[model samples]
Target: MTERLMNTLETPCLIIDAQRMDRNIQVMADMARNHQVNLRPHAKTHKIPAIALQQIEAGAVGITVAKIAEAEVMAAHGIRDIFIAYPLVTASKIERAIRLSQRIELIVGVDSLAGAQLLEQIAGRHGHSLQVRLEIDTGLRRTGVLYDQAAALAAEIAGMPHLRLTGIYTFRGSLLAGKPTLDIAAAGKEEGTLMVQLAERLRAQGIAISDVSVGSTPTAAYAAAVEGVTEVRPGTYVFHDRMQARLGACDLEDCAGSVLVTVVSRPSAELAIVDGGSKTFATDIQPGTEPLQLRGFGHILELEDATLARLTEEHGMIELGPQAQAANLRIGDKLRIIPNHICSTVNLHNHVVMQRDQAYKRLPVLARGMLE
Candidate 1:
């Protein structure tokens, strides 16, 4: 599409290049097949069920979500297989979990024996059983039981009445970004090795661990090839963001999603503001991995060598760097910005504009903000 046509569209809106997204989906799916791992692309990034179906149609076995509300949305949209990769321990969420199980194949993540017991009790009351995967904290230090302590928890959950221990999983998202000097591939290999060792130990303890999953867009491309890993749950590969590019996961051209904003003002020779702000672009900073430094909130595609200084609720401050005299940007000039975090930025928009074959179409973000 031409700049003229893009400018005619509304500002503070999202635009997705369909061709680029299709290519991204195919690339990740093929990577999984080559490594003999099943692909379960996470739906949390692009909560639209249609995109999940597109993934399923492209050799993905299922979809992964982060919350019960997200899983319920997928089930309502006819998605049958789902993995809620979150430690769901609250009582209110358990009732909704039961409802989702009745409608589809649901696999949940749990890090505690108490959480498993709570789910087991509810499943028993509904005359249902829950397929659960124990979350192992490889190194992120966020959620999940420690890797060494997983076997004991696995044994306890496997012996429970209504909850079955189907597998072990981990989300080492923090390790995906590699600095120019760091070895990212080695990190992925280490993660796979840790996961495989834990799975082997559980098998020896008489727990039939079938699935061993690991994920994150930065490491996902190479993680599938790891032995003993049955599945991968990468969410952001569908819409490569600036962070992915900064971390060496994808190139700028491969990023399909961008926040289209019009130049509202050129307050100074070096600074220009846009209609999109923190509310639109989100304030998520790129991962601070050593050797790979990202200096701004986002990158302006049209403004070569420009920096996004900061963003307020209604304004995106763009400070033209030393090269501004070269790229030459002016007021009323529309631009596309690749946000630091695509998932959070996507949730802020009600809909997105898709570009296919030089045409544009609007699609509602059906599952946006389904936080319940």
Candidate 2:
């Protein structure tokens, strides 16, 4: 008989600490409450419905996702309140989004007049309106309309019969990068200030704003405290990753997810190869205010100075620094790795072997590959 379930399981699998995850969820929920804002954490982090329910039970007002397919997955699992924190432009996606709205309290992110028009067309065909939060560009400069341009767009969107301009949101991803004197409260304050200013601009034009949302796990803790930030959409706080630890979003012990891999080769004194590779880990570098040109793709928990230096499709190359060499790892020895990006890392896996009270069980990544 197998000595234990873990011993019989394959390497290169995803493992999550259930207690750590619960604490992370509770803390974020409490933080949002203390800040007097609703916690609508992004679901793209774990993509697991059980965790989503855990968050709701912990006081999260709703769940947020990056795609309509993710929302569909959540709805199938009976997750009724969802915010698609991404812009939907394609017709097929719009049609699907409309159908999803029929079954849940759905809110989507919109940035452009063209996107608004497209949503309008979808609503016209479906005979129902789509609720949207205007995405505001607050410095990280990825998506969303310019802050100055929001008022006019709000006015334009309000004219569309099939669309309802619900509120405004922004992503200050740079704030997650730790500063020597990181004032998380201040970051949240600024984000709240920016979003509220834009929301007020819309309200001045008679737009009834209800959801003033700001996001990214780095600022979620503090963003909720902002005077007008109605909700926070932090995703990665559910499964704290190395990036979150390095950014000071959470302590290293708070990271709940890791990739379990077995050492497969020791070809050199400076490097070791592992069964896990790029396909198993994520290549996303840490994002924040400071340029975290992080040196490695992932960090090995067992080897203090070992960096998952590089990864190909099927193999990971670990470069051993002086301290890492002390571990003296051998072939067949297994270790855990904290990936740089937890959200993308989870997407690469089909399941997570979760540990609770020292017992392990599995949970499906139901939303994985839901790219539609």
Best by TM-score: 1
lDDT of 2 by residue, 160-253 (tens): 8988888888887644323322555677667878888888877888999988988678877666766777988889998898877877888878
What TM-score would you give candidate 2 relative to the actual structure?
A: 0.92
Q: How high is the lDDT of residue 45 in model 1?
A: 81
Error of 1 at 176 (Å): 7.6
Candidate 1 per-residue C-alpha lDDT over 1-372 given as tens digits, one digit per residue, 9 for 90 to 100:
697678679898999999999999999999999988999999888889989999999999999999899888888998999999998888789878888888889999999988998998888988888899999987777789987788889999999988889899998864432223245566667677789889999999999999999978887756676888889888888998887787678898999999889889988888988999888986756434345567677878866778888778989888887787466667788888888878899999999898897789888898898887
What C-alpha lDDT do the candidate models reach, one value each? 0.85, 0.84
Candidate 2: 10-residue stretch with minimal lDDT? 174-183
Q: Could you tell me which residue pairs clash in candidate 1?
A: none
Assess candidate 2 and give its lDDT: 0.84
